[model samples]
Target: MGSCIICGTDVGSGRVCDSHQEDVVFDFRGDSPNGLVPSRFYRGVVDGYAEFGVFVDLVPGVTGLLHRSELDRRLDTLDWEPGDEVFVQVKGVRDNGNVDLGWSIRQAEREFRGVLVQEPAGEHRPDEEPSDDGDDGDTEAETETDESADDDIEVADSVGDGESVDSVGDGESADGDAVEADADPEPTDKDVATDNEESAEVDATLASDGDEDSAVAVNGESDGAADEEVDTDADEETDADRERAPITTLGDAIGESIRIEGEVVGVRQTGGPTVFEVSDETGAVDVAAFVEPGVRAYPDVEVGDAVRVDGEVESHRGDVQVESDGLVLLDGEAAEAVRRRIAEALTDEARPEGLQPLGGDETVAALADDLLDAAEAVRRAVLESRPIVVRHPATADGYVAGAAVERAVLPLIRDEHAKSDAEYHYFTRRPLDEPVYGMDAATNDATRMLQDRDRHDEKLPLFLLVGAGSTTESADGIDLLSVYGVDAVVVDAAVADPETRDAVDTLVSPELADVDGDEGLSTGALVASLASAINDEVRPDLRHLPGASYWTDAPDRYVDLARDAGYDAERVAELREAVALEAYYQSYQDKRELIADLLFSDGGNLAAHVSEQFREKLETEIETADANVATEAVDGVEFALLDTDGYTHRYDFPPTPLLLDDLHRRHADGEPFATVGVGTDELYVRTTADVSVRDVAARAAEIAPTADIDTAGVREGKIEFLSGERDAVEDAVVAAVAEAF
Candidate 1:
């Protein structure tokens, strides 16, 4: 029989009783998995990791699986590496010679009251049992006497010169009194307790002292106190007696302790730790702190607060991060110092110098100031770790514009963040069906951002409207984003409404630069220049996009630029046709990879294959419409009208607007002419005259008093009318076109 080490209960075999098993730790000495006892705490070494669990070797050749489901925290958050010693409970030994382990909160040897060795022969006490003076009779008393004597010597050494032994306790011999050498030197209980109390007081005094003199002694200053002071001052010990390390230098300090001071730009809570993204003057890094599994660390700290983080630098999945030991919110001079440094750095880094437009387009050159402002905003967002969401129309020109900015900004995102997947998290492209940023798009963006803020504590994203959102029709959408304090920038080549200039935070448009609205400038050209300003490293990749955006009459400079970039006229045309055809099918989806392959990659076969489909579909639609064309002459102008519902595929490729554009180009014959493709409830007007769709719709409304007529798409020259008044609307539109020409 054996007595339990904790409660003194008698047991039949082992040192601990069944009720006291948890109070002790067991060392497994068996050679096989079958030798492990169930429900006993055993020490193990980490073997390796798997997706579902971790393997721990309980003995030299016996391993057990510590399933992730049995862990108290996330498996990824476990700092245990291979060969690291850990603690677990042997849950059971299976029939197939496998062992299952459970989580043990007590991981250290000192946390258990006693330890035992479990061998295949039987359970037995370890060689070194815990000392219990009360149970050891006279042998323990002799050991206590020796310890008391040692304590007396320590107390005497702590006393200063000329201080009497009485200062330690009343039990000591009095000053000027002599002790006989033959007298018993054994200490009484009172004397031993007094010595222990005095030793504790001296140890605590040395520990809490922070003065230079006290630090010298604590650091083993027997060599010389002056030399220790010199080394300490050189280190410039700050709070907690440690030197601060800059965040930018953390990459070299991995596996070493460091201190960093910065402003908290973002705070995210993961399944196991709270991650704070701290941005210093040089760069930003993620600092992780855990109070418990899934609990928030440093609840008092928030975004924009200046903080000092003391932690060890570690590499988590190839990204540099810090495991925090302490996080303190700064205030007063400390906070202001960090804030001032960050502000100066941001201002200097955000501004781009030497603004140069691509292809040397005069219109874009004239808008240099506005384009620079937009570029700065994008760069600043990347530095501050704010996400950038690009919204553009799903057209060939719009895709070209959005992709140009995307290629430039993605490389910058990769450089700024340490995570390999930062580009995916920090940049997004969302395509709109129409060339307008209406309420639906704004509401969707707002809801997603708000959810991200509440769940992940992410900063609100900056919205960049490319080739869209430059009309009074999009004002409401821009206002919705403004209501949430989200900044918006608009870059377009369309005839922008003057009200839109005031609606967005930054506006880059040709109209703003006093260029005529009909200057044949495509959005792709303007944004390509803006992309160059944002990231000059990617300027070479954007050389061909501007020319590929135009279906016809591309700017001469852009064409030469594309040719210089090795894309000839045939290749440029193929790329334009391919993008236009793909943009129509998934009118709302951003096919980033597919579009990049067609426009930027060396995928000649892909562009040629898609262009062939585009040509076949366009040619088929034009031939079918031409057979049913009706011609009429009015006031020296020839007007051709086709009933789009009867002559074309109503719901297939080559939509009504595109069909009319191709048909008008084929049969105009250099005369004063217009082609009108009339649908059931809408009609598109294509004319050689400089006439606006709004004017034609207004003139038609005046001619047919009972019909509802209005311009649906000003850019496409589309007018909508009541289905019952299709004939009247078409006749009035033709008359308006002849009168204007």
Candidate 2:
């Protein structure tokens, strides 16, 4: 861990100096030359290098480095010119103490202030203080299911409440504008936790360059002006120049224009819904029309038909609907190829937990499972197996105040002041300015990522928690007053009123799902880490003298309780166990969820993987069987077929037990099983046999007639034709068995 350049204290996990001087007085005067120490005062210079780099005055001189960079939304329209002086606070001091003398006031005021808040230093009996750790939420919101907005394919629903569609471009209602873009501010479309649209953009761009330039260009222009930005006076303007609707289907696009082009994979008429599986190599949306008497039907409008249907495109809730005007089906093979390409487009957003509708109940259950597991992981890593309570803040504002939070986390905290006594801060959002887990670089960076994700999204009642073994340059009190309250601004993060909260309560209940992120510290665990103080937990105990210092400058209130409960001797052991188990379990679940989602969720490519696997199986079987058949034919060998009836596999020509023993005996001499068949009347054996049946059977994949399942297929040789007797057909006479003779 690197110490803050401004202060000698550790900078925490992120390596960022959190030492903020909130009492920054704006001044353009340079106090030092050689560029003031980083985090020092920003000496606005009349002339300097431009862009991104910070400009600081030389120690005791007017010379300064130029910090030129783009402004964020927070800056709004504030333009800083050369010689422009802005008030800044001292964020850091040279670690050497003699390195330089200016301070950085900007960081301090931007929410990166104060040290991590820990428990109010006081000791108490372990069991004496009540722990409110276990979840008691049984709200109705958790059990309610949202309406599905898709047909044919059931689309995944949102986890949190949907955002309010307030305004849009073109002066039209938001209803028609940003149709597909208005997702909730919490968990995203793909199950990845995202802030709101504004925050989501930032979250997507952070540490990675997402498409931001074009989005910004159009965003800057309002509804009336958006159309003017692009040259529309030209007569050669193509459809591509037009503003694209977010939720549109092939049918709709085709209906509006002459070039109605797309590949159709299959057509199914079931339950009065005439479904057309079509895609334009970019995306695949289920298009269905009402099957009416007047509806025209082609002799073969099955799989692999490039169809051009001039129809209206309508977005019904989460689905894209297309109506047909003139339908033209293309070749089967070509359409099939396009269909496959379109299907791949679903991966654009890696939806976690598959495409299944995500409910509040599932979210809560998942979150709970994640919390409990994370606590255990931390405990195990520290080599301790003890019951420990976990504390998670409800908001993303500031760390929970006092020992009450620690007490709220059960057995983990054990008592009212246990967490505070241990110097761990509880959180649900990002701690205004503190390390996630001590002063480790990776840990701090991860925590920062978590905070940015939720903060920008405007989701949550957000809060960050500090945990045991945490230390910072400034005191928590300093942050609570100036930084956390003023700069962090937790209240601004809330998107809806109490009704939304009520809805969340119903959707995310304790009995359903819970948070689980990061193997050791990702996913929703990041939120828990922020809600509660992170812990490494496996360290030597500090000396406990008669009057020991506390996290909040007070003695631990629960230490006495521990002593009274006869835990003084075992307290240390219990503490170690709690910490380690917490870390281990949490970490394990994080990894599991990540992997499971990739392997099973709709965000994954499992369907593609399985499809490839079955196809390969079919291919292999065919190739191998053909080779064997060729060999048998060249050798002039003949085989006869026999019915397998009245001949049970058990107690037959080859006794199971005796056969196993014989095979084992032969295996010692290296012998393989020979080809043999048995019937009730006689035994038939062959050196070589045609195995084409296996290859065809291997190709018998069940295509999905509906969404979420695509396994069945219908073909001439692959069809199961019932006999004349139909349901009552007897086994005495088989209709027909298509075999290669």
- Tens digits of lDDT, candidate 1, 1-741: 444544444566555678767656788888888888789889889999998999999888999999999997657557678998888998999999899999986665544545677766555557544334313222445434433453342321222323233232322343634322223445432101122222221211111113432122222111111111222332234334766677778888999978888889888865345789898887788887653334466676788888777678988656788876556667667678888988888899888895788888888888889999999999999988899999998888989999999999998887777666677778989998778888999999999899888877789999999978887768888999999999999998876878887789999888666864338899998999999999999999999999998878998999999999999999999998899888888777778778889988856999999999999999998888899999999999998889998999877888677788889988888889899988889998998878877778899999987789987767777788899998898889988888888
Which candidate number has the best lDDT? 1
Tens-digit per-residue lDDT, 312-344, candidate 2 = 564432234554323445434534544454445
Off by over 4 Å in 1: 1-246, 516-518, 646-651
In candidate 1, which residue pairs get closer than 3 Å at backbone N, Cα or C atoms, i.e. clash?
A: none
Give the C-alpha miss distance for residue 46 in model 1, angstroms: 22
Tell me, what's the RMSD of every candidate? 12.4, 34.5
Q: Determine which window of 10 residues in candidate 2 has minimal summed lDDT.
A: 200-209
For model 2, the stretches where C-alpha displacement exceeds 4 angstroms are 1-273, 289-306, 314-320, 326-329, 336-741
